[model samples]
Target: MPKVLDCLVNVHFGEREQPAWMLEVRDKYFKGPQSMYRQVDLAELIDEMDEQGVEKAILMYSIVKPSPTALKFVEEMPDRFALAVNGVDLLHPVSSLRELAALVHDLPVAYTTVGPSFWGDGMYPPTDAVYYPLYYKCAELGLPLCMNTGLPGPPIPGEVQNPIHLDRVCYRFPELKLCMIHGADPWWDVAIRLLIKYENLRLMTSAWSPKRLPDSLLHYMRTRGRDKVIFGSDWPVLPMRRLVPEALALDLPDDVRDNYLYRNAQEFFFGGRSAGGTAE
Candidate 1:
């Protein structure tokens, strides 16, 4: 059986933390209620490790940049964490995609995400030439590239989170492990069908609420290839313990469930660190 892995988690310390307006939206529409994100970050990490019996995580968002935050965990417990480099928010003053590519070139980034963390532009698609090099860099690095599909409300508008927008990139960079996050939310159907058609692409369970997850996602994981699925909680957004039970309870095979939870990521990220050890 595969072990469950808390594939995603983060600690955010910024000048203005979890902005109030976005907080209001998250408080309302995010997977679980505020009750889930109520716990302190480290406490929840320890608690989830105890509750889920899982090992390893991709600790993103140790802000002020990715290297420092990721290094902290990696330096302490090397194999336990896969630190990522932060990509320039499309809305931020991203000088050029070339600059962004160069910034990540020498860093120990397992992979990175292209997103809308800034105030304006959203990473809509690869149609624009700027995103092509970004994809190329990912392919060159051979890292898992996670693209935000759909997480809306203050920060960005709802329309910007669509996954169909990824068509151009997926088509252009066939080898890139472009794992779609959040079931691509409203775009789940498009994403699922696309993955079905294109074997290289994959999906991760980032923020899908069991209560609200569409059946298409269940069918894809159940009927399609479980090996292609990855586990993610969009943590500080949805806790691992809270989300895993719902997924584990599904009718899929135990091994399939395990694969989705951690096995696949273990193989992908650590190349064989699937022994269920978080010890340094």
Candidate 2:
């Protein structure tokens, strides 16, 4: 059996230091009147992964700010944790590129993630010129850039989450590896086309519960697109204990499961290394 690699986990969502706007968004989408948002501590998170047989998890940061605590967590357990940085100020592309270069060079960060929908309707589309420098920097660093697609969890403009915008990006940055987070949901057909069209592009099934995974995505994962789809628990939103087993219980073949669980992500993020180690 292959070890699990959870491609998306958030360690800072419900923390006290998290921004009020984020908490508000969480309350609206993730929490209910009878339920409260619970922040998972580092120890608890590690234990959960251990119990669920997860070999590694990528800890994603908020777009508003990168969490120092997340950096510390990955620093403490470099083998088990990988950081996915956020908050690159696209308005200041030059400085943002420098910061991204430094982060990938100096820290245990595996890559960066962004939600184009968070910037609102008319601003910062994935194809915007503002992201060109960042794409170039990522290609230079040999890091895959992950971005959220499909409907955002919060009540943000869903139009911005369209997978079509990425078409232009893929065309422009052919050398840059891109992971479309959330499997592009309602746009699965377009997402599949993108994956087939662009050798450098892949998809991560994060945020979507296994039971809730779209049939089209399941078909792609089990068949021709096996090597292009990756697994992620989107922790805090969906518990790994539940998500992992649900994914493993799918009708997918063993090899497909192995690739989705770890191998594909391993190659995409870590240069297809046979030896196991955290991203540096």
Candidate 3:
């Protein structure tokens, strides 16, 4: 098996039950039994990753609060896990930047994240000026930014996450490394165009099954877009044990699958780190 680097995995506080909202999401979107959303024991997750040949994973934080437990994982297993700050308040850019700066100063934060549609009633798209400061700060600090794109699974308005909004943001901040997760459905044509147009942008295969990845995306991965795609389980939505094997089973060239599964993420999110977790 190729060494894996999961670009997105939400590891909640160890061994605790998942929140109610997550159960609803699993029921509505994943179509899996309640066990799919069950909380994971961190040690067991590591064993699973090892059994599955996963070298490392990026733990995405909550939308409501960054998990201290998540940070503890990074602190304890610096080589196995990295943190992505996803809970920052987009409406309050200044405070968000402050919190981000503090986290970056002390933690092995791989990147900051935003879910445009999950911003409650504000529903600010990625292009909204409110997010500019975060873009500016992440770029200045050499940190990447990951945002949810396409129609979200929950009941909220999905328009806010349309991939189209990223065009302006990308153009405005060319230095920022930004990734669109959750597979930009419906607007995949637009997503492909943007991925081709922007060198600093990437698409993560999170929240979507490998067998079902769009043909257009698969073709692109096999051709000119290999380096532009990254692997992410968005675990609990899609478990690592199940998702990794399915991904490896795809009819793709070894190099292409390598890029999708780990290499691209090493370069894109890990600052050109080697697969063994050493910086180039």
Query: Best candidate per TM-score, number?
Result: 3
Stretches of candidate 1 above 4 Å error?
13-16, 31-44, 62-70, 89-108, 116-119, 151-155, 271-280
TM-score of 2: 0.91
* lDDT for 190 (candidate 2): 94
Provide the lowest-lDDT 10-residue window in model 3.
13-22
TM-score for each prediction?
0.80, 0.91, 0.93
Model 1 residue pairs with clashes = 91-121
The alpha-carbon root-mean-square deviation between model 3 and the true structure, to one decimal in Å, is 1.9
Please give, for residues 130-184, the per-residue lDDT of candidate 3 as tens digits: 8888888999999999889989887779998889999999999999999999899
Position 260, candidate 1: lDDT: 81
* Model 2 C-alpha lDDT per residue in residues 183-264, reported as the tens digit of each score: 6878989999899899999999887777787788789887779899988877777789888899888888999988988889
Per-residue lDDT for 139-218 in model 1, tens only? 87677777666655455555555767677677878877777766676677887877787666877777665546777777
* lDDT scores of the candidates, listed in order: 0.62, 0.80, 0.83
| Candidate ranking (TM-score, best to worst) | 3, 2, 1
Candidate of highest lDDT: 3
Instruction: Estimate the lDDT of model 1.
Output: 0.62
Q: For model 2, what is the error of residue 111's alpha carbon versus the real structure, in angstroms, after optimal superposition?
A: 0.9
